[model samples]
Target: MQAKEIPVSKSDLLRADLQESLSHSHIDPAQITTFQRIILTTDGTLTEILEAYLYEKIQLVKLSQEIVASAQEIKALDLNIGTNIMNRKVLLQGKISRRNWIYAESVIVPARLDEIYRERLLKSQEPIGRLWLEHRVETFKEIIDSKRELAGELSDYFLIKSEDKLLSRTYRVFSKGQPIMMITEKFPESYFIDK
Candidate 1:
């Protein structure tokens, strides 16, 4: 059976002001280049990029994953799973050289996933991109938006002071034409620092 394509809602596109952020930002050119490299690239796992840029082994830390009935916003993504739909909220961190480089949260539709994929997602500490590649799941990513977060829990997690900001992007992953996951990743400014 062919997977049904999930339509992107107009509201979802409008909610993210990515164009303004990318086109009008005053961030340094090098930093902008780094952001584009990380956020714009549809290929390769982020772990690979971090390893190459930071010159260190990356570690995946699974903070939490819990099954929930639904998040209204995630449900709005219109995943094709039937009434059995359940959302998995996953929080994890990527560290390099013992320093946290990225924090990520994902709203995954377990009902839409194959049994093997669901098991791997729940049990593995590997990056999701790596897992997708290992399973040879043909997938496509849609970058919904990007932003500069100046304050909040994410900044606190990165130890950013009041005046500092973190770069972030929100995206969705689709496999077999079905929307399977929604992810938001926040990167610390230190990731762009020159060695």
Candidate 2:
């Protein structure tokens, strides 16, 4: 007799998608490197993780920040199209080694943020996770996607060839049961392999 098929849950499907995305970079999910695995799965503050792993403080270098209207594609932030949002980009680097570790882009709904949080986010170079901690904001991060792609313009920041692969993840942060920010973080696939 044929066995009955079990229904796949949404979380199960997401796991499958993540595995497929990792495989595109030639990574076997079962045999993924430590940092690569962390990058794929961790829903916590990456800046702290980098510091703990590298044994060096991390620096937040703000690249650019601007107020812009949200696009229809920005469904992750749960903002209406044409709503004002803070579009920001930055790099997380090793403070002592001066090595760029990760590049991140964030779309934040300013209206959803408290005045102090908005001010600090726009004016300070603090990592988002750190800001959340300082203000004692309760947050939940849900990873929405993961993939591998060519570095392209990001190659300049990582000092790698444009053809090099980058492992990336996109997630949305929610506070008070509302989506507050959507962020994407990317790092070269070749990094954090040896140690």
Candidate 3:
């Protein structure tokens, strides 16, 4: 599917004062209420929350690993999980920069033994392909909004946080991080590229 750019001004997106209101933890109740209404109207479920968070967390793990190799510090990352049960689209890009690379080495925490066991069971019962992530935020405000969207994506992810802030993610951050990365475009099937 083709993608469309979000129609928001750079300055509006980079607004400094509202940083606290961007994430699930900080947004005003009214703002959250709007999202709540949307979810309720669409009959969203608890499982959707878990699905989005799991996807986002897996993405950050890879990012943290990539950032570890660099000096930039990734203060925050937002990974777009996917369409919800209702198919509302959202976009997020986990991002890092040379200036912040030293601070951006935060990644998702490791899973518990029970989780590992569950994955083992699930893998045996059903084949699952590996997920991928890309980073795209350019400023702190986007970072904050992304986090909230991430929380909205999956409430459970709210429990996941920056642990051992210096740890590396599974994927490589590479030499220069892209500001507009398409982090997780899961292509399970091999498709033809014009180029």
Weakest ten-residue segment in model 2 by summed lDDT: 9-18
The digit string of per-residue lDDT tens for model 2 on 1-195 reads: 999999965346336556555555565655557677887777778988989888999999999999988767667776778999989999999999999999999989999999998999988989998999899989988877777789999999999999999988888899999999999999998998955
Q: Please list the residue runs of candidate 2 whose C-alpha ends up more than 4 Å from where it truly belongs after superposition.
A: 1-27
Q: After superposition, how far is residue 120 of candidate 1 from its true place, in Å?
A: 1.0
Off by over 4 Å in 3: 1-19, 22-28, 31-70, 74-106, 109-195
The prediction achieving the highest lDDT against the true structure is: 2
TM-score of each: 0.73, 0.86, 0.18
- Model 1 — which ten-residue stretch has the worst lDDT? 82-91
Clashes of each: 0, 0, 23
| RMSD list, candidates in order | 10.1, 5.3, 19.5
Task: Give the worst 10-residue stretch by lDDT in candidate 3.
Answer: 183-192
Best by TM-score: 2
lDDT, residue 136, candidate 2: 94
lDDT of 3 by residue, 38-153 (tens): 22122122124323533332112222222112133333322333211111111122233111111122232112113553344223321111211111212211122222222222
- Model 3 lDDT at residue 190: 12
